[model samples]
Each structure stands twice: as C-alpha cells, then as structure tokens.
Target: MTNPKSEPEMAGMETDQTITPVIMSGGAGTRLWPASQGDHPKQLLSLIGERTLIQDTALRLRGRATGFAFTDPLIVCNESQLVPIRTQLADIGQTAWFMTEPCPRNTAPCALMAALEIAGREPDALMLLAPADHYIRDEAAFHQAIGRAVPAARSGHIVTFGITPTAPETGYGYIEAAEPLDAHASRVAAFHEKPDFETARRYLASGNMFWNAGIFLCRPDVLIAEMQALREDIFKACQTTFAASPKTKDTRALDAALFAACPAQSIDYAVMEKTTKAAIVEADIGWSDIGSWRALRDLAAATDGNAVRGNVLALESKDNLIYTDGPLVAALGVDNLAIVVHEGQILVAAMDRVQDVKTIVEALKNKS
Candidate 1:
C-alpha cells in the first residue's frame, strides 16, 4: 500500500476546494439486535464515546482541514429516524442539511441523490460520502488522508480512502492498489469481495492490499456524470425523486412513490467497483466499521480481556463481552462469548459466531 504523506510533505499543497460531507445513516444495523432496532439503529446509540455515532461523524466534519473548507454535513436517513437524529445533532451543537429517504433504496440511490442535490447548488464542490456509524480513532490522520485525496478528486478522479490493513480481518472487502497516481495516491487495481480466512491471510501478507473503508471523495459533477453513464436507471430514479421532494431550509423529504420505485444496490456494486476513474489513498486512521457485537467487544475490551458495561458480573470469564442496559447480567465461566441484555431481551452467542446475529433477527421477524 502507498504510505500516507507526512504533514510537511502535504504542506503548501492547499487548495480552495469546498467539501460537503454526506453522512449516510440509513442502515438497519440488525447485527446489533436488542440495542439497535429498525427505528433506532447503531448510529443513534452512544456505543463508542459519549456522543452518538452520527453525532461524532458530524462533529468530525465541523471544522476545516488544512487544504479545504467544510460546509455543514448533509445527512441522508429515513423519515422515522429524523427526530432523534435532529435532536442528537442539536445536543452536540451541530446543524446539518437532512435528506430523508421515503424508503430504503441502498447506497447507490443515496449517493446519486446526494450528488444531484449538491450538484444543483454547487457543481464544482466536492462531496465526501461517509457512513454515519464508522469509528476513527485518529481524527487528525483522517483529515490528512482527506487532504491527500483532494488533488485526485479535483482532477475528476473518484477517490476512496483505503485503510492500511493491520491483521487478517475477514469482515471487510479489499482494494488492490495499482500504479501510483502521485506521491500520495494510487490507481485502483481491483476491488475484491470479502474473503475466507486463508484468503484474508494472503491479503494481509500482500503489501499492496488495503481494507475498503467505504468512504469516497469526488466532485459532485464527476459522480453525477459517472452514475448517469454507468447506472442510468438509478440515476434517473434518484433524479426524479430529488426533483419531486419538498425542500425546507434544513430538510428534503423525498416523495415516497418516486423513491420506492428506485432499485436497491450499494455504490460499490453500482459504480465504484466498475468505475475507471477510481483512485486510492492509503489511510492509517485506526478505522473500524463496528459491524457486529464481536467488533464492539474488540474495540472496548479492557486489560482483563473482558468488555463489560452497566450492571454485569463476569466471574471467571475471559475474552467475553457482557453488557446490560436493562437488568443485572451474571456470567460464570464463559469465554469468547457475547452476552447482551437490553430492553428485556437477552443475547448470548459465541464470539466467533457473532457475525450471524443478523440471522437470528431475521428468524425473530419471521416468527412475528
């Protein structure tokens, strides 16, 4: 992987680029079952720090970086989540432009709609598409990486920030970097799907592979043109929805009929993986998607190999995550497990199988 440029190396490379952060907050987060539900997802929960994930994301974009200026974040979320999200942002003293999806249509449509909206106002401005629920420990490093990506983005290349892999993590997709675009960026060679354990090890061993962080930077016009050329159906549908949506000073409520007619697909499958203008900037920002209970456990674990929160007793338990938001949870002689108690519901699963928690949620839905 290409090494991130040092602060001095990135000095004097400043530009007048205006970056609009588009925070995607429409995920269901079913893997975090009892604590995260349809109306209240992980982004709304204060899992990592005192601030909720969406609030943290917005706070990160509050000030300007070295090379660029930031406008208020544009949040893309569902109608049901609007009030809580607004309240959370208000609690943090941050304001945003909200785009409420009428229904779930995935990231491709979301990206298209964001691009259309931003392009309408300022076509030359850059849009940083970021997930509302990711954790980045080093905010300075993240901003530096964004600075590194700015040159390529202004040149009409769609830049994706790639996390330098620290281990053989099988949870995330991988991106292979080809030749160097400059001192700080590389041409994307290929995008690989999530691999098995053995393949993950191989990717870790390969120095050129990086974890896909799912964050993108590009000019709004560039993204709009690419979507129109590559995924015309999604582009047209989102355009129709955007045009029909009623706009207020701070919110855009999409038309339900127009939005529901759009197809569901991620930006990766719809455009990013297929775009020829893809570029990668290596970022060692201590990033984590926090996709499952095991991931949260790993992030919050203490010196005793246990991550405990609320009223919980973990006796003779090593490498276990015990959390309670409702009642006292007592555990004895359990290792490599996740035990969560929230809102009168309980979950006990082996850590290795925690990724399958979404399946249990699906089963519960079927039973109802």
Candidate 2:
C-alpha cells in the first residue's frame, strides 16, 4: 500500500493543511436483501451505473480542481469486506487509506477511528463523514453545498447535510432546523426518528424539517472533543484500537480482536443526539438513501410511470416496477407492484407494502 501522506497532489491539498474523507461502509442493507447480501453489502453493489456505490463515493472526489478543498478519504470498513473494497478502489484507479473494523462496532467507533487518523496528519483537520451507498443525482449542487458547509466546519460546528423532503417519508429520520447560519446553512433544532404516516405528513406540511442525509462535515478536533464529552468509552476504545493497529494494507489480521472488544453504537445515538455542537445544512439535490427494493424501483422508473430492468417481460403491466438480474420475470396486468426476481427468490408485492419484506426475511430465518 502506498502512503496516504505521499498523495498530496491528488486533491491539491497543502502540505500544512489536510482534510480527510471518512466513509462509513459496514451495513448489511437488509432492506435491499437478495441483491445486497451479508457477504457483499449495498455499498459494493453497482446499483446506479458501471461503478459500485463505494467507487462512486471514491470517485466523487475526483474532478476538475474545485476551490473547495479535501484530501483523500480514509475508509472505515468491515474485515470481511476488504477484498471487495480493494477491488472497487482499484476499479476506480484510486486508493483510500483503509481502517478495517475488527467487528461491526457501528458508526461511532468508525468515526472515532477516522478522527484519530485525521488528527495525526493535521490536528485541526476537517473530515467529510458520509455513507458509501447513498445517491445524490446532482453532483454540482452537492459540491456547492459542501462549499457552503466548509466554513461552518472551520468554525468548529458539526454540520450535517439535511435533504429537503419531497414527500412524507416515514423511513428517514428528520432534522428540524431553524434560522440560516449564513444563506445556505441552518442551526439544527433536534433530530427525530421515523414517525408514523400522519406525523410524517405533518412534518412535511411544516416545512421546517429535512430528511437526515447522514452526511456530516466537521473538524477532527471538534469531533474528538464532542465524542470525549458525549461518548468517552467510544473515544477511548478508538484511541486504543488505532494505536495498536498497524497502518498497512493487511488490516484483516487484527480486525476480529479489536472489534470484539469495542462496543457497537450508531453515530446518532453515540454522539449526535448528545452533542451541543450539532448543526444542519438544508438542501435538495435529489438525494435518497435507497433503503429498500421499493426505493430502487421508484428511482429507476421512467416518465411513463414504469421502471423495468434485466430479463423482464411485461404484458399489460402499467405503473409497475420490476428489478431482476436473475430469472426471467414475467408481469401480467399488474400496477403499483414491485417485482424482484433474483436467484431462487422472487419478491412480488404491492409497492406500498414492500417495507414488510423484512418480516418475510424474519420468518425465513425462523424456518432455518
């Protein structure tokens, strides 16, 4: 593995300053099961175009020299996924400094490890923390939003990107923000979990809420301080784990022992909910978490109100969404239904009821 320190020219980063991207890529993506499996999660899936989600994230940093500055990312991924990680990065003709988790210790530990690494390079280094599997259709707008948030990060605020909600989505957490920090940013009021349909409708009507985009920008020192105050146990574990692990290509050897010792917790529960420095940026640039097969179908839908992919044969099918990479899918006179044909599994359900696919997965587990 080449030294990350030697890749200064990639981002046009200054010798005196550094900003690392921290990608959190360790979710099973259960909602997108069948296609997204435990062995190969959603981030590794090539859902959009030729590039996998992980590669798209890594390549997001590669473009014409933008004034908004950033360094190469430090990817925090699971031990079992190192091979896919390597292959994905190689496919993009880029390499990221990887810190493999010994176990699935969640985003809190992941972010903390990233902060520890970033702190070593520049004590006040900024970090762009994001998931690898999210979709943003507007890259120019995303870059513009990042430019707006950079000053907020510099001023020691943990800035989170909140998507302007297009619908009453009960699946996403909401961020209530009031008053703009500048022209484009806002001070976060609170974070709320997924609500019921009626409550989601109210949130949508209020116009003060944004879908939690799970994208954060902050300085390493500020995050360290916040984690130290809000989640000391996680902070200490991360410090110890980073100290013991060698910064090399072969990080799989120590992953199990280290992860087993660390506690599992999401960043929201571990730090964001408890931090007073929490702030949010409200923007709508066509963002989606792609949480379910339903969402994937909706995203691929054409203007005529139908989405079809793979070996799909539809007859008299209107307003139906079909996704199949395996098995010949034949749809007849179905509307508002999602059909997923893969492997030996065939999922055919009402689009509105697709969220209950997890229940079926649970029942299948019981049968095993």
Candidate 3:
C-alpha cells in the first residue's frame, strides 16, 4: 500500500495518458457450477493456462507488446471475492486499483463508476472495459483491435470490439456492422439479441455480423454524457456511490445503500442501443466468453475428441467434457456430456443443455 500518485487507474496515471483497461470481474458462472460459485467465480478460477482468467487478463493488458503504453489496469469486482482476488494478484505480483460492488447491479453502474472516477483525472483518457472471465488466445490481434478502437474513442465515439464469428453461434449476441467507419472500424447498424440457429446462420452468411465480445472503449466524458442523458438514475446513483467510497490499497468500497438503489442493467440496454455515436471494431482475437462447460470444453485441447481434466479416464467416450477435483471421474460410452466433480457436489449435464445449468442452480437455491 505504498502511496502512489493516485489509485484505481489513477496513482501512476499522473503523467501518462493512455487507454486504461477496466476489467469487470463479477459474473458468477451460473452455468459452470460447483467450481464457479459466489465465493469463487469464473474469473478467479484457473480454467485456462497457468494463470486464472483475471490474472491472464491483467497480464495480457499489462502494456506489454500491445503497441500502446496502457496504464495499470483497474478492476471492478464483487465484495465477497476481494480477499481471494487480492491474494491472486499478489501472487502474480500485479498491482491494480479495485472497485468493489455493494451488490450485483450489472455493467451499467460498473461502467459509470469507472468512467466518472477515471474521467476526474483525465477526461480525454480512453478507457477500455473488458470482462475478466473471457479467454483470448490471440494476444497480438487483441492489441491490434484496441489500437484501432483508440482513434474512435479519442474522437468521442463509444466503441465496442466485435469478435469475428468463426461459426454461427446462437448463444452470443450479434452486432451488425452497418457502414464502414474506416478499414478497421464500422458504424454499428444494429445490436441483435441472441437469435435462433437459422437466424444465426443468416448472420454468418451475411458477413456483416460480428459477435458482441462485450468489450467497450471510450473516453470517460463520452460515457458520462451518455449515461447522464440516457440512464441518468444509474449515473447519479453510481456518482454518489463513487464519491462516498473510501479508497483502500486493493478495494474502493462503494456506499452499499446507494449502490443497491441503482438500476440493474447492462450497458447495451442502458446506452449502446440508443447512442448515436456507437462504433464497433471487428476483432479476430481468438475470443471465447467461456459462458458454459461446453464452451470451455470446446476451447480445450481434446484427447480422442473429449476434453478431460484432472483425474479423468475415458473409454469409448467422445466429444464429452469431464472435470474432477479429487475423484477419479471415469466415463464409459458417453458423448457430449459434462461431468464435473467438486467437493461433494457432482454435476452431470448434457453438453447441449449446459446453458440451462443456471436453471439447476436456481432450483437448488430455491430448494434450500
């Protein structure tokens, strides 16, 4: 806790003016149960490489070879996860300013809190909002996308990075690129909700649609203005909460009472859909939201076409996902199933129905 110039994308931000990577780390993997819970969410879990997803996020945006000198990242996370998150960052020797949510109120308020806080110092400084739980295998391409988006951000247009859809993914939302903003960016024609498989195939065939990666870049002023104009209640509430919060080494504690009053909404619903200055950058960054076990398994390097982790044995099993913590998970004659063993809880899901695991989680909650 050495006193720096400022904190939370602040502190060392005294001189340098660069796009700050604001990592949102709160979503509990409802679909990825047992392993991803309220206490230990998806971002904190090491589902990918040696580092946890959040750690990997920090490292990737660590001003490495991105061709941009990004400031130390700022993270918006949950209150229940603070200690473990701090320990993880400490273990990795990465320092970041953290803003803890009083409760889960979605990305609109989170964006507001970050925008207003960072804008106080540098109104023109670009802020790039990224989800912590996502996986991007192509680091270079990601940096390239950010570089392209920075110009639009600097021009006062709120920009979102749209992933080039490799397949017709019905699970993710689509962004239709209306007009070419430039060779690298485009004017967002329409934001399409998750569509049926036929519609998704049409989107893929059109070549004008990109998967919404939920990554946003804009100046704090632009976002502040948009929120004030469109979602004023959320803006006001977050402003009050941000102003009341006491900044600490690892956490900025928002006013719990006030934050709870803020409207729970995503940025898309709050501002993006309505904004006239919305722009998008087509990014091919090998991206995956990892929203389900099936997604994680799909991204994993498979053996005999089955994704198996930990003490796993598979015989005649193909295209299935098996994960175990302390038990020897054996699968025979099973295909496209997700079998996860954690502690005393066992989750067995059909790969196609993995997204509905949230339903199971809610049912279990209701039972207790």
Evaluate residue 248 in candidate 1 and report its C-alpha lDDT on the 0 to 100 scale: 93
Instruction: Pick the lDDT winner.
Output: 1
Residue ranges of candidate 2 with Cα displaced over 4 Å: 1-18, 63-66, 249-255
After superposing all C-alphas onto the true structure, candidate 2 shows an RMSD in angstroms of: 5.0
Candidate 3: residue 142 lDDT (0-100)? 93
- The candidates, ranked best first by TM-score, are 1, 3, 2
- Candidate 1 lDDT over 321-348, as tens digits, reads 8889968888898799989888889999
Cα error, residue 139 of model 2, in Å, equals 0.4
lDDT score, candidate 3, position 367:
100
All candidates: CA RMSD (Å): 4.7, 5.0, 5.1
TM-score of model number 3: 0.94
Per-model TM values vs. the true structure: 0.95, 0.89, 0.94
How far in Å is the alpha carbon of 237 misplaced in model 3? 1.3
What candidate 1 gets wrong by more than 4 Å, as runs, is: 1-15
